[model samples]
Each structure stands twice: as C-alpha cells, then as structure tokens.
Target: MEQVPLRKIIHIDMDAFYASVEQLDNPELKGKPVAVGGNEVRGVISAASYEARKFGVRSAMSGAQAARLCADLIFVKPNFDRYKEVSKQIRKIFHEYTDLVEPLSLDEAYLDVTENKKGNPSATLIAKEIRQKIFETTGLTASAGISVNKFVAKIASDFNKPNGQKTVNPDEVEAFIEVLDVKKFYGIGKVTAEKMYQLGIYTGTDLKSKSIEYLEEHFGNSGKAYYNLSRGISFSQVKPNREMKSIGAERTFFKNLSSEIYMEERLNNIAEEIERRIKKYKIAGKTVTLKIKYSDFTLQTRSKTLPYFISDKGLIFETAKELLYQEKLKDSVRLLGISLNNLNTHQKKFVVYQLKFEF
Candidate 1:
C-alpha cells in the first residue's frame, strides 16, 4: 500500500496585535505599557501590550482590575477599522506563499503550505519568510509554529511568543505533546483544565493514559477530541473560506441596571451593530439569540428562530426586544449581547483535495 505523506502546517499569530498596532501608529507609545479598549471606570481590556502583560494584565480582564495591577497602564480606545486594514496587509503577505490561508481572527491564521506556490520544501523557512514579510509590510511582529498538523502547529506557535517561532518535526510531535500541561492545549480552557486536574490529568501524558470511554464519560463529545489531541492526532483542515457560524456584538455596562427600559436601549445599539456585521458579510440569519449576563456573572440565552432569514436592524431589534421581555430580570443585568445564527451563508459543496509532502 502506498503511504500518505505528512502535511506541512504553519500557524501565524501576530504579537500583541491590537496593542502593537496602537504602538506602531503612535511612536511615543513604544516601550510603554499600553492597553487597547476600555477605561479605568468601565469596560474590559481588549488587548494588552507585553509591557502591560508583565503586570498580569490580560485580554477580557476588567479595566479596573488592569489599572489596579499596573497604575501606569495606558488605555487606548480600540480602532478596529485600522486593525482590519493592517490585518489585510498581513494576509496579503501570506498569499504570496500559499492560498491555503485560514484566518482564525484579525491577528492569527493557519496556513497549509505543504504544496505552496513557492515550491518551498521547508515549512520552517516558509514560516520565517512569512513572519519577516509581515514585519516589513506592516511594521508588526508575528510568531509562528510549523508542524505536520494544525493542532500541534497552533500550540507550538505560542511556545516562543512576541516575535518568535517553534517548529515541531514529525519525529518530535508525540514527545513534545507528552510533557505539555493540559492547560496549554489549544482547545482546553481554564475551566476544562481545572476539571482535568481534579481528575489527576495535569499533563498530556496523564491525559493520554485515560481511556476514551473514561474521558467521554466526563467531557462528553469533547472527550473524544481530547483523547486524539493528547496523542498528537488532529485532522482539521486549513479552510481558506471558513464559515462564520454567527455574528454578534455585545457591551458591558459600567453600572448594573435594574430597569428594562435602559436594557432595551442597549439592545437596540447591539442589534444595529449585528445588522452592520451581517451586511458587511452579505449574510442573514433565521435565529436571533439574546445573551444576558447578570451582575453576579450568571449568563442566560434566549433564542428565537424566524421562518425566514433577516438582517435589517429594525427587525433584529424587534426580535431582541421580544426576547428581553420573554423572561423577567433575574438580577441587575451587567451585560447585553445580540447574535444572529442559522445564517444564510450555507456551506458550499466542494470535493476534498489532499495536498501531501513530496518526501
């Protein structure tokens, strides 16, 4: 039987994307602790610079806590338009090497360069060239991970960060994953890591020792994924035209509100944002989900699927309004979000083509 060749995957992630962009545009902000988005009074940090990170500031952390951590933290309002422009420039650089570019967000992407336009034999060299091109083109630094598969590549990318890269050879894959902490696994979050720890699964080796049945019993569908990932096995492809499952916008209020009227006003704004996003992507959705987070950090989601897809702001707002009143307030609400799912952007039918290494 002829053997299938290994793939060459590279995961490229911009270093402190939002915060770095802020510093690049304003030279004075360089070498200083910077944060993009939010104020000390309200909102959360969208991104923090490496300097701010030294003080334990992190994305999704409340601005107040960030300020308490670093009194010198400089807060800058987010300019997504500018960030998107830079992201486009970086993506253009990736296309020079390969078209199998799957962007995870504005700041990171996975590229399948096994059969690239450049005919480059070394995935490591391709990753280096791509990162260099990104720095030269946008004055931004990117870190990369090169491996035979996307799962290991994504994790390896973070091993050396803020302008660095790591390459996991095919022979080194299994051992590299063995010693890694469960928390460092790409899909494993803090909550899942804690659960794994409680089960005495602190490292990849420990996780690998568990039976598939045991993991599935505890983690359900995700357990199967964990089992595979522990053994350095992942079959996920780098899809250039990855589907957007949902589009949503949310806001966290500075103060918790008890009034439904105030919440309605906020929902209108969020609905408008959602409409804009769907329009930008030229898609509509049949399902409108209203996400509410109480002051105590409890979350509630109420969804309504319409018979037909809709993307108008007025229509979206009306649906969200219905959901808002669908249930009474449990506690003073701290956040409100509006999302549209069951989108009109249905998956396109295509034949799968596997690109393999020559060797």
Candidate 2:
C-alpha cells in the first residue's frame, strides 16, 4: 500500500478585517463601535467591529437595522483598492514560507506548510511566525490554526481571536473533534445545524454514533461529508493558484425590468465583458451559463454546453439569449449575468519533437 504523507495545514483569519483596517487607518475609530458600509436605510453593513458586534451589529445586516441595534454605530465606506494592496502584502509573506497557499478571501487563507521554505518541521512554529510577521508588517492581527487538514484548521483558527494561535496534533484529532458542536463543522450551516439538532446529533460524538445508512437516509450526499468530518477525515488540500472555475460578471438594477429587450441588451454587455476576460486569460470554454435574479430575490440559472470551445462575444451572447428564451420568466428580473466554464487554458503548452536514430 502506498503511504500517504501526513500534511500540515494552517488556516489564518484576520480579526474583523475591514473593521480592523478602518481602525488602523484612523485613530479616532479605535475602541469604538464601527461598521464598514453606508449608513443609509437601504445600505447593508459589510463588516462590524467587535464593539458594534456587542450590540448585535453584523455583516450583511441592513444599516437601518444596525443603527436600531446600536444607536452610535459608526459607518465607514469600504476601501477595496487599499484592501487588495494589503492582501497582496499578506500573500507575499505567505509565499516566503510556501507556495501552497489558498486564499479564501481578502481576509482569510489556508496554507499547507508541510514542506516550507524555512525548513521548519513544526507547523505550530511556522503559524506563529507567520502571524507575528503579518502583525509587524501590516499592523493587523491574524488568528492562526495549525492542524493536519484544512477542515480542522479553519475551525481551530476561530478558537482564539484578535491575535492568537492553536494547534491540533495528529494524536489529538479524534478527541478534539468529538466534543465539538455539530454546528461548528464546516459546511454545516444554521439550517443544517437545526436539522442535526432535530436528529439529536448535536456534537461530533453524537454524529459519529449515527450509522452511515441513517445519515444518508436523512442528508443525502452531505451524509458522506458529515460522516467523514465526525472522524476528522477531511482530505481537502490547500490548492495554490487554483484555476478560475468560471469567469462571469453580474449587475443588479435599481429597478426591475419586465421587458426581454432590455434584458437582452444587458446580456450583450455581460457577454462582451466575459469575452474580454476570456481573451485576457487566453481561455476558451464550452459551457455558457445565464443567471437571472427576480425582483423577489429568487435566482435562476440556465446553461448549455457547446460541442466546441469558444471565446467569441457574439456566440456567448447568442447562447445566453437561447438559454433565456427557453424558459419563461417567472417574474420581473432585477439582475442578469453571463459566465463561461469547462476551461482547459491552464494546460501546459509544448512543442512536439521527432527523434532520429542512427544504427
């Protein structure tokens, strides 16, 4: 049997990233309840500081609701360009250790440091150093979690916040997961957690007690994942420079449009954008997908796979039109998007050579 190497993974999450950045830039915002977004009735909060969180302010909550919760909540507009620059700096620091870094977002990432540049055997030490370096360089605090796999590492990262580190060793993996709440497991959202509670599976141990057949009968495909997670058996790797799964663009309108003509115009613009991105990336895809969002916030997607790969804007727009026309609109659409998938552009390019032999 082939031996599988025991990998060391680290998941790093910034401590209230946008909020922290806001506080870092302005001294006055420090030690105050801050939210990053417009403070309008319809505007939503992108992030909230720990102080604001105390008053139930949260990301994705309406500004009006946040205001009602916290009367003096401070709102700051997001600076995405500045955030991107900071993200680049953080990525640079990660690459100094290992290239096996998977960025989840601007604020979080997973790093596989099993064979790091520093020649360190201990993942714990590497995570510690990385956190320290990030703080020293970016004036931001990052929480680190080191474990044998990405799943546990991500959960452990949240164990300590605002600058902390935690390690779950190989020997302790089983015990560490057994007592954990089922809700804490990755992919187990609130709805699923409620279902789990109904089934009396509140912790890892309780989940492990249920037979695979029982889980499958209830959860379908997710049963396998839940079974594996209960045993600390996630096999997901820290993939670096993961190819773009799909290239797409979307737009949300201020008002819903019932006319197909206006939607087709929007589709043309979206297709043009997708084509430009495909050309820029030198990618050709066979699958085209059209996404529509109704005024009621319901989303629908229709897709078709062509016989051959294409990156042409005309074809993209036509295919999207075909998909859109195939199904009658259930309601007025507020958003339209176009995307391409099934790409093979990242394949290696090579020149074939013929060998001549003399006897």
What is the C-alpha local distance difference test score of candidate 2?
0.87
Q: What's the true lDDT of residue 294 in model 1?
A: 90
Per residue, candidate 1 scores C-alpha lDDT tens digits across 205-280 of: 9999999999999999998889988989886778899988999999999898899999999999998888778878
lDDT of 2 by residue, 2-103 (tens): 232357889999999999998999989999999998574545578999999999999977677899999999989899888888989998999999998999
TM-score of each: 0.94, 0.82
The positional error of residue 10 in candidate 1, measured at the CA in angstroms, is: 0.6
Q: Between which residue pairs do clashes occur in model 2?
A: none
Estimate candidate 1's RMSD in Å. 2.2
